[model samples]
Target: MREEAPRTVTAICRALQEQIECGLLPQGGKLPAERQLAEVFDTTRITLREALGQMEAQGLIYREDRRGWFVSPPRIAYNPLVRSHFHAMVGEQGRVPETEVLSARIVPTPAEMCARLELPALSSVIQIRRARRIDGRLVLYVEHYLNPQVFPGILDFDLTRSLTDLYASHYDIRYGRVAFDMVPTALPAEAASILKVTAGSPALLITRVNRDQHGRVIDCDVEYWRHDAIHVSVEVPD
Candidate 1:
């Protein structure tokens, strides 16, 4: 018989991250006690503490003095292009909006993403690819990168649901400032498949990054809007 290698805290954290993202553990809920978690993972309490510490730093869980650790709520959505929720945009047109969370995971931030986030060095980012629809017709494709350390359980929430409401109700995030950059581009191969469009089709590529009240980077995203489908009319504040 072969002996198994002892589990480390990093491994435990990754497992927990995966579970949270997959909804195995519900959001805003308490995590298992240290003793129980250690036993479950076949690890030591010290290692479990280390793993929990990393998660705490990432805003995934908070430890009460007497109580145990609990998962943090989901983050809010603030569009730099306009002062509106994607849901609100569809609602105004007398259309219902639906979202399909295509893909999501935790990975090292790419160079471009690091620059947008203004992160010092390489950092972990939460990657989310989703499609937005109006009247059951696909209209918008979004790729969002959030600071994994700042928005824990990001993978756990039902992303088909509205993230904007989740941020406000769970984390008390009010609103965010907006900045946008737009470009004309041909649709990439992968994006075309999900958007149900032909490759190299004309599209509007808009990049945006959101900041909180304290000026912390909350989220950065790129949106691909089909040129033939929808155009926007904006109203400025008085």
Candidate 2:
């Protein structure tokens, strides 16, 4: 029985993968309920969940809180080397992009953020929290920390607009030096909850730090993305 269950889970994963790839399970389509699926597979709910998790980690599917699993849409191609903001990049990929400003306020900088921005201890920065969706599916939760000295009264504007455009038109500041650090990590509870996934779900964390034209560190962003939602592609000129 033990050996039989392991093979059954593998069989279930394979069968569903084929179905999804063949378009029987269309992208963005919700999967049957766990109980229904378990019955179809002739397996217990526990085994079915294991199979679903395997597929989720493989970027083949995703699960929402209180909603069942869903066939994942095509992953967005992200080229970090290019200077593009969230909305621009999503639009270029032929996907509808939307952002919701969760909160924006001046917050005392934490030690880690202060060091990253090279700001003096105890300095506060404009912290903007946002949730972004692609094709109307929540996929990213991000926070922007900007040097208060560089952008005064920025909080007065609509926070959902691209920061890249605002930097040029509102402040006449262009990014000169930028750096990115990426790592595979477990999504924090705050971000995962906002994305409608379970806490500690698999995710990719991309940390971006930027300097203005005069070499002054102006802002940094911590972006938490659904691991399956983006395919990072960097293009280089030879």
Candidate 3:
């Protein structure tokens, strides 16, 4: 019957999911090639891929750009409510965190970012771009836009280190009240390339608009995180 296709795909997906959860497919272990898996399951490649897609969506597995699917590692717990920076948070969870500055320069603020930073047209913002990794796997790519006036000569500082510490010590400025917005998105080409994933891979976009001590908009950060690499956590205090 026509209705059998969905049932077949769901069965394949559950079988693979069980393998992953039961540790038969170890974390970071590459899955067998598509053809091999299809043969093993005695199903069409199309059906196998459909099943794999379900696993990817459920965060049980992931695919790299050129590399095939692999069992995912434990997700990093991300608490947007916490003030700690990337390195600190990863360290607290006993995972290695690495950041590399991709690019840094002064650039005319893009219209969308200009609004977020509350800057006027033709204004310049110090833009620093970086890619972050966890446990030796590429995970996040981020772009930082800062009001040039507020952070004079910001480019001189090492951009790979924590922005929070850079200004806290150099400019006597600390992160003040902040706002966070998160959305599900497909990774852009640039971000996906840097993170070693296929373009349009699933991603989580977190936009942070930060204000200074006096309540003035100081900077904004746009972060693209590999969906399977992070677990969003928010704890409410009683």
Candidate 4:
């Protein structure tokens, strides 16, 4: 028999990645049985398990105790700068939260975005595009990016629903610390279209990052506030 090159976990992950790329495995689909994979690769059970573990780490799959691994879903988003929930934010000034999800997908993070999030190159990221309205009047257009591995099934969530509550109840993510910075600018054509405002209208671009009890970054969100509608509250540091 020809000498067989030792199979490694990286090789296993690469094999699965290729399968996914070729559509042999579709999104939201379960992975093969561990034993079947082990047999196909002609590898020891331990080596097969190592491969599975690597895949899980890369957000390709998720495993439940006593249950097998399944393909992992995308991540959800919430801003940490403001102490208000999504519902509360919309409800401010007695406005109803009306939201429409424009798009949700997984993509390789761009260099600019990766730098902001401090993520590695080519890491998988979930992007959410949405429009928010108050009293049936559009006021904000948002593009959210999240790390899918941390908060799975985020894309399946009701986009109009309160993401903050969902994270707290489902994922045990409660942001204990929040910080934000703001910059003033004229609304671009794209943002104006969704907000139903004229181009060059004044706007506030707010950047926020939040940390959980364990000091892990739970959420990082950028908010676009209509100039006429938003108010700033601050305390100056000595």
Candidate 5:
């Protein structure tokens, strides 16, 4: 009976895997409830969940809080040095992009942040938190720290829109030098909660520092992304 149970789980996994591969289960489509799925697979709930867990680890599916499992969309390709904005980049790949500003405020800069921006101790900065979604899937949460002195009254503007455009129109500040450091990490509780995933799930952390024409740091951004939702690509010249 033990040997037969293992084979049953494997069979269930293969059956569902085929559906996903064949597009019978479309991307972003939610799977049926656990009880329903168990019935459909003709297996015990425990065995069915085991099969589904494997698929989740394989990046074939994901789960949302209080929601069912869903087929994951194709990973977006991100070029670190590219000047494109998030909306433009996602649109180029035939996906809809949306951004929601979670909060914005003028806060005393942390010691490390002040050092990064070359500001005096305890300088004030505008901090913005935002969530980004692609094709209706929440994929990234970002925190931006901006030098308030450079762009006074910045908090008065609509922050939920594209910051790139806002910078150009208001301050005529375009991107200059950008530095990126990316790593795979376990999602923190705050980030995972916002993205509707389990805490400590696999994720990607991207840290960026942007400079102006004069080499003065303008902003520091930290992005937390779903590990299965993006692929980083960049070209190198010999």
Candidate 6:
């Protein structure tokens, strides 16, 4: 006998939840197609979709446009005090990290940016935008603003590689004291589009100011990360 709509939805949700809990559907694994999943659950497409929607709301799954749903991966641990860059941190967890440079240019520093970097009025800053991924999933988008006077000719270098390494190698400027500010917010449109997530999705906004040994500001970084994609952790002394 065909079950009632409510009962059918509940049963399907329970079954899929069990699959995830029991590791039958591993983290980061793609869920079966909608048609296949519906047939296996012996439910109508609408019911199956309802079940999937429940899972997505619970952060058990996520969808990419033009791509099917995937089980959510465990969040990456991020320590604000750690000096490691994104690549090292992701690699330490055995996940592949990739970066794509979206744009690099010299633009007049905005008022707020000038204050953040302590730049003089009418200063020009080198801005670089990048998308960072882990295991082929977009996790972070960043905008880097560099002091042009400190890093002359920086725009001529290959911007796709790690900026940390570039700073050390090309300019002998290693990271010194750093400051971090984090906030919970909704993803902006450009970030949402690049990350393949809907606008207004929950996210973390992290702002970092990097300095050199001489206490001179090197650059400031603004990073936006999916709320479900990272876990921030830090150890504080008693």
Among the numbered candidates, top lDDT falls to 2
Scanning candidate 4 in windows of ten residues, the lowest lDDT window is 72-81
Clashes of each: 1, 0, 0, 0, 0, 0
lDDT of 3: 0.91
Q: What residue pairs clash in candidate 6, if any at all?
A: none
Model 4 clash count equals 0
The alpha-carbon lDDT assigned to residue 178 of candidate 6 equals: 98
TM-score of 4: 0.60
* Candidate 3, residue 134: lDDT: 90
Local distance difference test scores for all models: 0.74, 0.94, 0.91, 0.68, 0.90, 0.90
- Looking at model 2, which ten-residue stretch has the lowest summed lDDT? 1-10
Deviating ranges (above 4 Å) for candidate 3: 1-3
Worst 10 residues of 5 by lDDT: 1-10
TM-score of each model, in listed order: 0.63, 0.98, 0.95, 0.60, 0.92, 0.86
| Predicted candidate 2 versus true structure: per-residue lDDT over 185-231, tens digit per residue | 99999999999999999999999999999999999999999999999
In candidate 3, the residue pairs with backbone N, CA or C atoms under 3 Å apart (3 or more residues apart, or in different chains) clash, namely none
Summarize candidate 4's per-residue lDDT along 139-226 as a digit string, tens digits: 5677777767768998887866767787788888887777676798777888876675557656678776666777766556767755
Error of 3 at 4 (Å): 3.8
- lDDT string, candidate 5, 56-141, tens digits: 87788988989989999999999987898899999999999999999999999989888877889968888999999999899999
Model 2's lDDT to the true fold? 0.94
Instruction: Point out where model 2 deviates above 4 Å.
Output: none
For model 1, what is the error of residue 186's alpha carbon versus the real structure, in angstroms, after optimal superposition? 1.1
Could you tell me which 10 consecutive residues in candidate 6 have the lowest summed lDDT?
Answer: 1-10
lDDT of 1 by residue, 1-238 (tens): 0132234766888899998898887776789888999899887777788788778656566454456776655432333446667888667666677898989999888899998887757788989999987666565799998887677886888877776777777667645676688787877987776777567756679888887767778888898875544555555678
